[model samples]
Target: MAEHVTPPGIDIGTMHPARRYDYLLGGKDNFEADRASAETLLKFFPATRINALENRRFLRRAVTFLAREAGLRQFLDIGSGLPTAPNVHEVAQGIAPQSRVVYVDNDPIVLVHARALLTSTAEGATAYVDADLRDPARILTHPDLLGTLDLTRPVGLMLVAVMHFFPDALKPYEIVDRLVRAMPSGSYLAMSHGTFDYLTPAKRAELDALLARSGEPAAPRGRAEFARFLDGLELCEPGIVPVSEWRADDEPEPRPDPAEAAVYGAVARIP
Candidate 1:
Protein backbone atom coordinates (compact mmCIF):
# COMPACT_ATOMS: atom_id res chain seq x y z
CA MET A 1 0.00 0.00 0.00
CA ALA A 2 1.09 3.58 -0.70
CA GLU A 3 2.00 5.82 2.25
CA HIS A 4 -0.26 8.81 2.98
CA VAL A 5 1.30 12.25 2.43
CA THR A 6 0.09 15.41 4.10
CA PRO A 7 -1.37 17.93 1.67
CA PRO A 8 0.44 21.24 1.20
CA GLY A 9 -2.62 23.39 1.97
CA ILE A 10 -3.11 22.32 5.59
CA ASP A 11 -2.73 25.16 8.10
CA ILE A 12 -0.71 23.99 11.07
CA GLY A 13 -1.01 27.41 12.74
CA THR A 14 -4.76 26.92 13.25
CA MET A 15 -6.36 24.28 15.46
CA HIS A 16 -8.12 21.30 13.89
CA PRO A 17 -10.80 19.30 15.67
CA ALA A 18 -8.91 15.99 15.42
CA ARG A 19 -5.73 17.54 16.78
CA ARG A 20 -7.60 19.23 19.60
CA TYR A 21 -9.20 15.89 20.43
CA ASP A 22 -5.79 14.24 20.41
CA TYR A 23 -4.49 16.88 22.82
CA LEU A 24 -7.46 16.31 25.11
CA LEU A 25 -6.70 12.57 25.06
CA GLY A 26 -3.10 13.30 26.20
CA GLY A 27 -1.65 12.28 22.85
CA LYS A 28 1.60 13.82 21.54
CA ASP A 29 0.56 14.14 17.87
CA ASN A 30 -0.93 17.61 18.40
CA PHE A 31 0.79 20.94 17.61
CA GLU A 32 1.28 23.99 19.81
CA ALA A 33 -1.78 25.66 18.28
CA ASP A 34 -3.99 22.69 19.13
CA ARG A 35 -2.65 22.57 22.69
CA ALA A 36 -3.33 26.29 23.11
CA SER A 37 -6.90 25.91 21.89
CA ALA A 38 -7.49 22.90 24.12
CA GLU A 39 -6.27 24.85 27.14
CA THR A 40 -8.71 27.67 26.38
CA LEU A 41 -11.58 25.19 25.99
CA LEU A 42 -10.64 23.65 29.32
CA LYS A 43 -10.98 27.01 31.02
CA PHE A 44 -14.66 27.24 30.06
CA PHE A 45 -15.44 23.52 30.02
CA PRO A 46 -13.30 22.17 32.83
CA ALA A 47 -14.42 18.65 31.97
CA THR A 48 -13.01 18.61 28.45
CA ARG A 49 -10.53 15.84 29.15
CA ILE A 50 -13.12 13.82 31.04
CA ASN A 51 -15.54 14.20 28.15
CA ALA A 52 -12.97 13.02 25.63
CA LEU A 53 -12.03 10.00 27.73
CA GLU A 54 -15.63 9.01 28.32
CA ASN A 55 -16.40 9.30 24.62
CA ARG A 56 -13.47 7.03 23.81
CA ARG A 57 -14.60 4.49 26.39
CA PHE A 58 -18.09 4.58 24.92
CA LEU A 59 -16.62 3.87 21.48
CA ARG A 60 -14.81 0.78 22.77
CA ARG A 61 -17.85 -0.59 24.60
CA ALA A 62 -20.07 0.03 21.59
CA VAL A 63 -17.67 -1.71 19.19
CA THR A 64 -17.25 -4.64 21.55
CA PHE A 65 -20.97 -5.08 21.77
CA LEU A 66 -21.35 -4.97 17.99
CA ALA A 67 -18.64 -7.54 17.40
CA ARG A 68 -19.27 -10.00 20.20
CA GLU A 69 -22.98 -9.74 20.94
CA ALA A 70 -24.39 -8.39 17.70
CA GLY A 71 -22.30 -10.70 15.49
CA LEU A 72 -21.14 -7.86 13.30
CA ARG A 73 -18.07 -8.42 11.12
CA GLN A 74 -17.81 -5.18 9.15
CA PHE A 75 -17.22 -1.62 10.39
CA LEU A 76 -17.36 1.78 8.72
CA ASP A 77 -15.84 4.33 11.09
CA ILE A 78 -16.27 7.82 9.67
CA GLY A 79 -14.33 10.78 11.10
CA SER A 80 -11.93 8.35 12.68
CA GLY A 81 -9.27 10.54 14.22
CA LEU A 82 -5.53 9.91 14.53
CA PRO A 83 -4.81 6.26 15.14
CA THR A 84 -5.25 5.43 18.80
CA ALA A 85 -4.69 2.30 20.85
CA PRO A 86 -7.52 -0.24 20.82
CA ASN A 87 -8.93 1.19 17.61
CA VAL A 88 -12.12 -0.17 16.04
CA HIS A 89 -10.31 -2.78 13.99
CA GLU A 90 -8.30 -3.84 17.02
CA VAL A 91 -11.34 -4.27 19.22
CA ALA A 92 -13.45 -5.95 16.56
CA GLN A 93 -10.81 -8.18 15.00
CA GLY A 94 -9.78 -9.28 18.46
CA ILE A 95 -13.21 -10.79 18.92
CA ALA A 96 -13.68 -12.08 15.37
CA PRO A 97 -10.52 -12.22 13.33
CA GLN A 98 -12.32 -12.09 9.98
CA SER A 99 -13.81 -8.65 10.60
CA ARG A 100 -13.21 -5.90 8.01
CA VAL A 101 -12.97 -2.14 8.67
CA VAL A 102 -12.83 1.05 6.61
CA TYR A 103 -11.89 4.28 8.39
CA VAL A 104 -12.72 7.68 6.89
CA ASP A 105 -11.43 11.17 7.76
CA ASN A 106 -10.77 14.41 5.87
CA ASP A 107 -7.97 15.80 8.02
CA PRO A 108 -4.61 15.92 6.25
CA ILE A 109 -2.88 14.98 9.49
CA VAL A 110 -5.11 11.94 9.81
CA LEU A 111 -4.38 11.07 6.18
CA VAL A 112 -0.65 11.17 6.91
CA HIS A 113 -1.23 8.70 9.72
CA ALA A 114 -3.62 6.48 7.75
CA ARG A 115 -1.05 3.75 7.46
CA ALA A 116 -1.32 3.11 11.19
CA LEU A 117 -5.04 2.53 10.84
CA LEU A 118 -4.56 0.11 7.94
CA THR A 119 -3.07 -2.63 10.04
CA SER A 120 -5.33 -5.69 10.13
CA THR A 121 -5.35 -9.21 11.45
CA ALA A 122 -4.30 -11.88 9.01
CA GLU A 123 -7.90 -12.99 8.73
CA GLY A 124 -9.36 -9.45 8.38
CA ALA A 125 -8.98 -6.30 6.29
CA THR A 126 -8.57 -2.56 7.04
CA ALA A 127 -8.52 0.51 4.78
CA TYR A 128 -8.81 4.32 5.07
CA VAL A 129 -10.64 6.96 3.02
CA ASP A 130 -9.54 10.62 2.91
CA ALA A 131 -12.92 12.33 2.67
CA ASP A 132 -14.99 14.81 4.64
CA LEU A 133 -18.13 13.82 6.54
CA ARG A 134 -20.12 16.64 4.96
CA ASP A 135 -19.90 14.82 1.62
CA PRO A 136 -21.63 11.58 2.37
CA ALA A 137 -21.91 10.66 -1.29
CA ARG A 138 -18.22 11.06 -1.82
CA ILE A 139 -17.46 9.05 1.30
CA LEU A 140 -19.87 6.30 0.30
CA THR A 141 -18.47 6.10 -3.20
CA HIS A 142 -14.79 6.24 -2.29
CA PRO A 143 -12.83 3.36 -3.82
CA ASP A 144 -11.23 2.44 -0.49
CA LEU A 145 -14.59 2.26 1.23
CA LEU A 146 -16.14 0.27 -1.60
CA GLY A 147 -13.21 -2.12 -1.74
CA THR A 148 -13.07 -2.89 1.97
CA LEU A 149 -16.71 -3.04 3.00
CA ASP A 150 -19.56 -4.86 1.29
CA LEU A 151 -22.50 -2.44 1.43
CA THR A 152 -24.89 -5.32 0.84
CA ARG A 153 -24.03 -6.75 4.22
CA PRO A 154 -24.65 -5.43 7.69
CA VAL A 155 -22.00 -2.99 9.01
CA GLY A 156 -21.29 -1.20 12.25
CA LEU A 157 -21.38 2.50 11.34
CA MET A 158 -19.14 4.17 13.90
CA LEU A 159 -19.71 7.95 14.12
CA VAL A 160 -18.21 8.62 17.51
CA ALA A 161 -17.58 12.20 18.66
CA VAL A 162 -17.30 13.77 15.21
CA MET A 163 -20.75 15.13 14.40
CA HIS A 164 -20.43 18.19 16.67
CA PHE A 165 -17.97 19.64 14.18
CA PHE A 166 -20.74 19.94 11.61
CA PRO A 167 -22.78 23.10 12.09
CA ASP A 168 -26.54 22.91 11.62
CA ALA A 169 -26.14 24.62 8.25
CA LEU A 170 -24.36 21.49 7.09
CA LYS A 171 -27.47 19.42 7.77
CA PRO A 172 -25.59 16.85 9.82
CA TYR A 173 -28.81 15.00 10.47
CA GLU A 174 -29.45 14.61 6.77
CA ILE A 175 -25.89 13.49 6.17
CA VAL A 176 -26.32 10.81 8.83
CA ASP A 177 -29.61 9.81 7.29
CA ARG A 178 -27.97 9.41 3.90
CA LEU A 179 -25.29 7.15 5.32
CA VAL A 180 -27.77 5.09 7.28
CA ARG A 181 -29.98 4.77 4.23
CA ALA A 182 -27.12 3.34 2.19
CA MET A 183 -26.46 0.60 4.71
CA PRO A 184 -28.43 -2.64 4.54
CA SER A 185 -31.05 -3.60 7.09
CA GLY A 186 -29.67 -4.90 10.41
CA SER A 187 -26.73 -2.48 10.12
CA TYR A 188 -25.90 -0.56 13.30
CA LEU A 189 -25.21 3.10 14.06
CA ALA A 190 -22.91 3.62 17.02
CA MET A 191 -22.39 7.29 17.79
CA SER A 192 -21.37 9.81 20.48
CA HIS A 193 -21.98 13.53 20.09
CA GLY A 194 -20.95 16.46 22.30
CA THR A 195 -23.71 18.34 24.14
CA PHE A 196 -23.98 21.66 26.04
CA ASP A 197 -26.92 20.45 28.16
CA TYR A 198 -24.59 20.14 31.11
CA LEU A 199 -23.28 23.69 30.87
CA THR A 200 -24.81 26.91 32.15
CA PRO A 201 -25.84 29.63 29.73
CA ALA A 202 -22.77 31.66 30.62
CA LYS A 203 -20.45 28.71 30.06
CA ARG A 204 -22.13 27.85 26.79
CA ALA A 205 -21.58 31.40 25.57
CA GLU A 206 -17.96 31.23 26.67
CA LEU A 207 -17.57 27.92 24.78
CA ASP A 208 -18.97 29.47 21.60
CA ALA A 209 -16.57 32.40 21.86
CA LEU A 210 -13.61 30.12 22.55
CA LEU A 211 -14.39 27.91 19.55
CA ALA A 212 -14.89 30.90 17.28
CA ARG A 213 -11.60 32.41 18.38
CA SER A 214 -9.85 29.10 17.78
CA GLY A 215 -11.45 28.73 14.32
CA GLU A 216 -13.18 25.44 15.27
CA PRO A 217 -16.74 26.36 16.13
CA ALA A 218 -18.94 23.38 17.10
CA ALA A 219 -22.70 22.73 17.41
CA PRO A 220 -23.34 20.81 20.59
CA ARG A 221 -26.94 19.55 20.77
CA GLY A 222 -29.39 18.62 23.53
CA ARG A 223 -30.86 15.18 24.38
CA ALA A 224 -33.89 15.39 22.07
CA GLU A 225 -31.88 16.85 19.20
CA PHE A 226 -29.19 14.21 19.57
CA ALA A 227 -31.79 11.44 19.63
CA ARG A 228 -33.14 12.67 16.31
CA PHE A 229 -29.94 11.49 14.62
CA LEU A 230 -31.05 7.90 15.27
CA ASP A 231 -34.60 8.45 14.13
CA GLY A 232 -35.05 5.52 11.68
CA LEU A 233 -33.11 3.03 13.73
CA GLU A 234 -34.14 0.83 16.62
CA LEU A 235 -32.22 1.96 19.71
CA CYS A 236 -30.58 -0.70 21.83
CA GLU A 237 -31.28 -1.01 25.51
CA PRO A 238 -30.37 1.92 27.81
CA GLY A 239 -30.47 4.30 24.87
CA ILE A 240 -29.05 7.79 24.51
CA VAL A 241 -27.27 8.45 27.79
CA PRO A 242 -24.03 10.14 28.82
CA VAL A 243 -20.99 8.30 27.49
CA SER A 244 -19.73 7.17 30.92
CA GLU A 245 -22.95 5.32 31.71
CA TRP A 246 -23.55 3.55 28.38
CA ARG A 247 -23.40 -0.15 29.20
CA ALA A 248 -20.41 0.56 31.39
CA ASP A 249 -18.70 -2.37 33.04
CA ASP A 250 -18.89 -2.58 36.81
CA GLU A 251 -15.65 -1.33 38.30
CA PRO A 252 -14.34 -0.99 41.80
CA GLU A 253 -14.09 2.80 41.48
CA PRO A 254 -17.14 5.02 41.16
CA ARG A 255 -18.00 6.17 37.64
CA PRO A 256 -17.27 9.76 36.68
CA ASP A 257 -20.17 12.18 36.94
CA PRO A 258 -22.27 12.19 33.75
CA ALA A 259 -22.18 15.99 33.70
CA GLU A 260 -18.42 15.85 33.42
CA ALA A 261 -18.68 13.58 30.38
CA ALA A 262 -21.04 15.97 28.59
CA VAL A 263 -21.39 13.67 25.58
CA TYR A 264 -24.33 11.41 24.65
CA GLY A 265 -23.81 7.96 23.12
CA ALA A 266 -26.09 5.22 21.77
CA VAL A 267 -26.12 2.13 19.55
CA ALA A 268 -29.09 1.66 17.25
CA ARG A 269 -29.92 -0.98 14.66
CA ILE A 270 -31.63 -0.44 11.32
CA PRO A 271 -34.67 -2.66 11.25
Candidate 2:
Protein backbone atom coordinates (compact mmCIF):
# COMPACT_ATOMS: atom_id res chain seq x y z
CA MET A 1 0.00 0.00 0.00
CA ALA A 2 1.26 3.50 -0.85
CA GLU A 3 0.40 6.84 0.72
CA HIS A 4 -0.80 9.79 -1.30
CA VAL A 5 0.18 13.44 -1.10
CA THR A 6 -0.61 16.23 -3.50
CA PRO A 7 2.34 18.49 -4.12
CA PRO A 8 1.56 22.19 -4.50
CA GLY A 9 2.73 22.50 -8.11
CA ILE A 10 2.62 18.81 -9.08
CA ASP A 11 -0.42 16.52 -8.99
CA ILE A 12 1.35 13.15 -8.79
CA GLY A 13 -0.68 10.89 -6.45
CA THR A 14 2.11 8.83 -4.94
CA MET A 15 5.69 10.01 -5.38
CA HIS A 16 8.78 7.82 -5.37
CA PRO A 17 11.87 8.43 -3.24
CA ALA A 18 13.73 9.41 -6.39
CA ARG A 19 11.19 12.19 -6.75
CA ARG A 20 12.01 13.23 -3.21
CA TYR A 21 15.64 13.34 -4.31
CA ASP A 22 14.71 15.91 -6.90
CA TYR A 23 13.26 18.10 -4.18
CA LEU A 24 16.45 17.78 -2.16
CA LEU A 25 18.35 18.96 -5.22
CA GLY A 26 16.59 22.35 -4.78
CA GLY A 27 13.84 21.89 -7.31
CA LYS A 28 10.63 23.72 -6.42
CA ASP A 29 8.04 21.13 -7.49
CA ASN A 30 8.27 18.39 -4.85
CA PHE A 31 5.58 17.90 -2.17
CA GLU A 32 5.66 18.02 1.66
CA ALA A 33 6.15 14.27 1.98
CA ASP A 34 9.03 14.43 -0.49
CA ARG A 35 10.68 17.19 1.45
CA ALA A 36 10.25 15.19 4.65
CA SER A 37 11.84 12.09 3.14
CA ALA A 38 14.68 14.14 1.71
CA GLU A 39 15.33 15.64 5.11
CA THR A 40 15.51 12.15 6.55
CA LEU A 41 18.11 11.16 3.96
CA LEU A 42 20.18 14.26 4.74
CA LYS A 43 20.11 13.32 8.41
CA PHE A 44 21.61 9.96 7.44
CA PHE A 45 24.07 11.19 4.78
CA PRO A 46 24.96 14.88 5.04
CA ALA A 47 26.99 14.82 1.85
CA THR A 48 24.09 13.42 -0.24
CA ARG A 49 23.25 16.83 -1.64
CA ILE A 50 26.81 17.33 -2.84
CA ASN A 51 26.93 13.79 -4.16
CA ALA A 52 23.78 14.39 -6.21
CA LEU A 53 25.30 17.55 -7.68
CA GLU A 54 28.47 15.67 -8.63
CA ASN A 55 26.39 12.97 -10.29
CA ARG A 56 24.59 15.65 -12.28
CA ARG A 57 27.95 17.02 -13.32
CA PHE A 58 28.88 13.55 -14.50
CA LEU A 59 25.74 13.51 -16.63
CA ARG A 60 26.68 16.77 -18.35
CA ARG A 61 30.21 15.60 -19.09
CA ALA A 62 29.08 12.23 -20.41
CA VAL A 63 26.51 13.81 -22.70
CA THR A 64 29.11 16.27 -23.97
CA PHE A 65 31.47 13.41 -24.74
CA LEU A 66 28.74 11.57 -26.60
CA ALA A 67 27.57 14.55 -28.61
CA ARG A 68 30.75 16.49 -29.29
CA GLU A 69 33.58 13.99 -29.08
CA ALA A 70 31.90 10.78 -30.27
CA GLY A 71 29.55 12.46 -32.79
CA LEU A 72 26.48 10.53 -31.66
CA ARG A 73 23.08 12.17 -32.06
CA GLN A 74 20.27 10.07 -30.58
CA PHE A 75 20.13 9.47 -26.81
CA LEU A 76 18.12 7.18 -24.51
CA ASP A 77 18.37 8.55 -20.95
CA ILE A 78 16.85 5.80 -18.86
CA GLY A 79 16.01 6.57 -15.24
CA SER A 80 16.52 10.22 -15.93
CA GLY A 81 15.47 12.13 -12.84
CA LEU A 82 13.87 15.54 -12.39
CA PRO A 83 14.65 18.08 -15.04
CA THR A 84 17.76 19.68 -13.68
CA ALA A 85 19.66 22.36 -15.51
CA PRO A 86 21.82 21.06 -18.34
CA ASN A 87 19.91 17.80 -18.73
CA VAL A 88 21.15 15.26 -21.28
CA HIS A 89 19.25 17.00 -24.03
CA GLU A 90 20.43 20.42 -22.89
CA VAL A 91 24.07 19.31 -22.84
CA ALA A 92 24.03 17.29 -26.07
CA GLN A 93 21.86 19.67 -28.02
CA GLY A 94 23.97 22.59 -26.87
CA ILE A 95 26.88 20.94 -28.65
CA ALA A 96 25.29 19.87 -31.94
CA PRO A 97 21.90 21.59 -31.74
CA GLN A 98 20.45 18.67 -33.71
CA SER A 99 20.83 15.83 -31.22
CA ARG A 100 17.61 13.97 -30.50
CA VAL A 101 17.03 12.78 -26.92
CA VAL A 102 14.44 10.50 -25.30
CA TYR A 103 14.12 10.70 -21.52
CA VAL A 104 12.61 7.73 -19.65
CA ASP A 105 11.19 7.50 -16.12
CA ASN A 106 8.27 5.63 -14.54
CA ASP A 107 7.34 8.10 -11.82
CA PRO A 108 4.25 10.20 -12.53
CA ILE A 109 5.90 13.20 -10.87
CA VAL A 110 8.85 12.80 -13.21
CA LEU A 111 6.49 12.49 -16.16
CA VAL A 112 4.87 15.80 -15.27
CA HIS A 113 8.24 17.48 -14.77
CA ALA A 114 9.51 16.05 -18.05
CA ARG A 115 6.60 17.45 -19.99
CA ALA A 116 7.33 20.81 -18.37
CA LEU A 117 11.13 20.91 -18.82
CA LEU A 118 12.00 18.66 -21.77
CA THR A 119 11.56 21.12 -24.60
CA SER A 120 13.74 20.66 -27.70
CA THR A 121 15.30 23.09 -30.08
CA ALA A 122 13.71 23.64 -33.47
CA GLU A 123 16.37 21.65 -35.24
CA GLY A 124 16.24 18.69 -32.83
CA ALA A 125 13.50 16.85 -30.93
CA THR A 126 12.96 15.70 -27.34
CA ALA A 127 10.31 13.40 -25.84
CA TYR A 128 9.68 11.69 -22.51
CA VAL A 129 8.47 8.12 -21.99
CA ASP A 130 6.74 6.84 -18.87
CA ALA A 131 8.52 3.49 -18.57
CA ASP A 132 10.66 1.58 -16.12
CA LEU A 133 14.17 0.25 -16.61
CA ARG A 134 12.86 -3.20 -15.71
CA ASP A 135 10.61 -3.06 -18.77
CA PRO A 136 13.28 -2.84 -21.45
CA ALA A 137 10.99 -4.08 -24.22
CA ARG A 138 8.36 -1.45 -23.47
CA ILE A 139 10.98 1.25 -23.15
CA LEU A 140 12.75 0.27 -26.37
CA THR A 141 9.57 -0.07 -28.38
CA HIS A 142 7.93 3.03 -26.89
CA PRO A 143 6.26 4.96 -29.71
CA ASP A 144 7.85 8.31 -28.88
CA LEU A 145 11.28 6.68 -28.74
CA LEU A 146 10.82 4.90 -32.08
CA GLY A 147 9.67 8.10 -33.76
CA THR A 148 12.58 10.19 -32.45
CA LEU A 149 15.40 7.63 -32.52
CA ASP A 150 16.62 5.48 -35.38
CA LEU A 151 17.43 2.01 -34.05
CA THR A 152 19.86 1.40 -36.93
CA ARG A 153 21.84 4.50 -35.99
CA PRO A 154 24.16 4.57 -33.00
CA VAL A 155 22.57 5.93 -29.79
CA GLY A 156 23.96 6.92 -26.41
CA LEU A 157 22.33 4.87 -23.64
CA MET A 158 22.34 6.96 -20.48
CA LEU A 159 21.72 4.97 -17.27
CA VAL A 160 22.95 7.38 -14.68
CA ALA A 161 22.42 6.86 -10.92
CA VAL A 162 19.38 4.59 -11.18
CA MET A 163 20.40 0.90 -11.32
CA HIS A 164 20.94 0.53 -7.58
CA PHE A 165 17.19 0.04 -7.16
CA PHE A 166 17.32 -3.31 -8.96
CA PRO A 167 18.23 -6.03 -6.51
CA ASP A 168 19.53 -9.46 -7.64
CA ALA A 169 15.95 -10.67 -8.11
CA LEU A 170 15.51 -8.39 -11.14
CA LYS A 171 18.94 -9.35 -12.58
CA PRO A 172 20.02 -5.81 -13.55
CA TYR A 173 22.77 -7.22 -15.74
CA GLU A 174 20.23 -9.08 -17.87
CA ILE A 175 18.19 -5.88 -18.11
CA VAL A 176 21.19 -4.03 -19.46
CA ASP A 177 21.81 -6.90 -21.85
CA ARG A 178 18.31 -6.62 -23.29
CA LEU A 179 18.71 -2.90 -23.93
CA VAL A 180 22.25 -3.29 -25.31
CA ARG A 181 21.30 -6.07 -27.69
CA ALA A 182 18.67 -3.82 -29.21
CA MET A 183 21.05 -1.01 -30.06
CA PRO A 184 23.24 -1.05 -33.16
CA SER A 185 27.00 -1.34 -33.03
CA GLY A 186 28.89 1.84 -32.13
CA SER A 187 26.24 2.88 -29.59
CA TYR A 188 27.58 3.99 -26.20
CA LEU A 189 26.51 2.83 -22.72
CA ALA A 190 27.10 5.47 -20.08
CA MET A 191 26.34 4.64 -16.44
CA SER A 192 26.88 6.00 -12.93
CA HIS A 193 26.07 3.29 -10.38
CA GLY A 194 26.06 3.39 -6.58
CA THR A 195 28.18 0.86 -4.67
CA PHE A 196 29.01 -0.10 -1.05
CA ASP A 197 32.75 -0.45 -1.63
CA TYR A 198 33.56 2.33 0.81
CA LEU A 199 31.02 2.06 3.64
CA THR A 200 31.85 0.94 7.15
CA PRO A 201 29.73 -1.80 8.70
CA ALA A 202 27.92 0.69 10.93
CA LYS A 203 27.36 3.18 8.11
CA ARG A 204 26.15 0.45 5.76
CA ALA A 205 23.76 -0.72 8.44
CA GLU A 206 22.50 2.80 8.92
CA LEU A 207 21.96 3.19 5.13
CA ASP A 208 20.21 -0.13 4.89
CA ALA A 209 17.89 0.85 7.71
CA LEU A 210 17.17 4.17 6.07
CA LEU A 211 16.28 2.53 2.75
CA ALA A 212 14.01 0.08 4.52
CA ARG A 213 12.26 2.89 6.38
CA SER A 214 11.67 4.80 3.17
CA GLY A 215 10.59 1.80 1.11
CA GLU A 216 13.56 2.10 -1.24
CA PRO A 217 16.08 -0.63 -1.99
CA ALA A 218 19.82 -0.21 -1.57
CA ALA A 219 21.85 -2.74 -3.59
CA PRO A 220 25.33 -1.30 -3.98
CA ARG A 221 27.83 -3.38 -6.02
CA GLY A 222 31.63 -3.60 -5.91
CA ARG A 223 34.14 -2.67 -8.59
CA ALA A 224 34.27 -6.20 -10.02
CA GLU A 225 30.50 -6.55 -10.04
CA PHE A 226 30.10 -3.10 -11.58
CA ALA A 227 32.68 -3.96 -14.23
CA ARG A 228 30.77 -7.11 -15.16
CA PHE A 229 27.99 -4.99 -16.66
CA LEU A 230 30.44 -3.76 -19.30
CA ASP A 231 31.97 -7.15 -20.00
CA GLY A 232 31.51 -7.19 -23.76
CA LEU A 233 31.68 -3.47 -24.52
CA GLU A 234 34.99 -1.66 -24.95
CA LEU A 235 35.51 0.72 -22.03
CA CYS A 236 36.78 4.17 -22.77
CA GLU A 237 40.19 5.22 -21.47
CA PRO A 238 40.65 5.37 -17.68
CA GLY A 239 38.12 2.50 -17.43
CA ILE A 240 35.77 2.52 -14.44
CA VAL A 241 36.61 5.05 -11.73
CA PRO A 242 35.01 7.21 -9.06
CA VAL A 243 32.37 9.59 -10.42
CA SER A 244 34.56 12.63 -9.61
CA GLU A 245 37.76 11.04 -10.91
CA TRP A 246 36.74 9.87 -14.37
CA ARG A 247 38.46 12.07 -16.96
CA ALA A 248 38.77 14.83 -14.39
CA ASP A 249 40.87 17.61 -16.00
CA ASP A 250 41.91 19.24 -12.75
CA GLU A 251 43.31 17.61 -9.63
CA PRO A 252 40.30 16.62 -7.51
CA GLU A 253 40.27 17.54 -3.85
CA PRO A 254 40.97 14.52 -1.67
CA ARG A 255 37.75 13.06 -0.26
CA PRO A 256 36.54 9.92 1.51
CA ASP A 257 37.81 6.51 0.37
CA PRO A 258 36.36 5.07 -2.84
CA ALA A 259 34.17 2.78 -0.75
CA GLU A 260 32.86 5.79 1.16
CA ALA A 261 31.77 7.60 -2.01
CA ALA A 262 30.52 4.21 -3.18
CA VAL A 263 29.80 5.28 -6.72
CA TYR A 264 31.36 4.22 -10.06
CA GLY A 265 31.10 5.83 -13.51
CA ALA A 266 32.11 4.59 -16.96
CA VAL A 267 31.28 4.69 -20.65
CA ALA A 268 31.65 1.82 -23.10
CA ARG A 269 31.10 1.37 -26.82
CA ILE A 270 29.25 -1.59 -28.27
CA PRO A 271 31.30 -3.61 -30.76
Best by lDDT: 1
**What are the lDDT scores of the predictions, listed in order?**
0.89, 0.83
* Top TM-score hit: 1
- Per-residue lDDT of candidate 2, residues 1-271 (tens digit): 1454543445454456567768767777666677777788679877677667667777888888889889999999999988889889889989988999999987777787789778999999999998888889999899999999999999999989988778888889999999999999999999988876677889888988888776766677888988988989999977899887676675366644465446899999998
Give me the displacement of residue 78 in model 2, in angstroms: 0.7
Q: How far is candidate 2 from the true structure (C-alpha RMSD, Å)?
A: 3.6
Candidate 2 Cα misplacement greater than 4 A, ranges: 1-15, 250-260
User: What lDDT tens digits, residue by residue, belong to model 1 across residues 137-176?
Assistant: 9999999889989999999999999998888889999999
List the lowest-lDDT window of 10 residues for candidate 1.
1-10
Candidate 1 lDDT at 185 equals 96
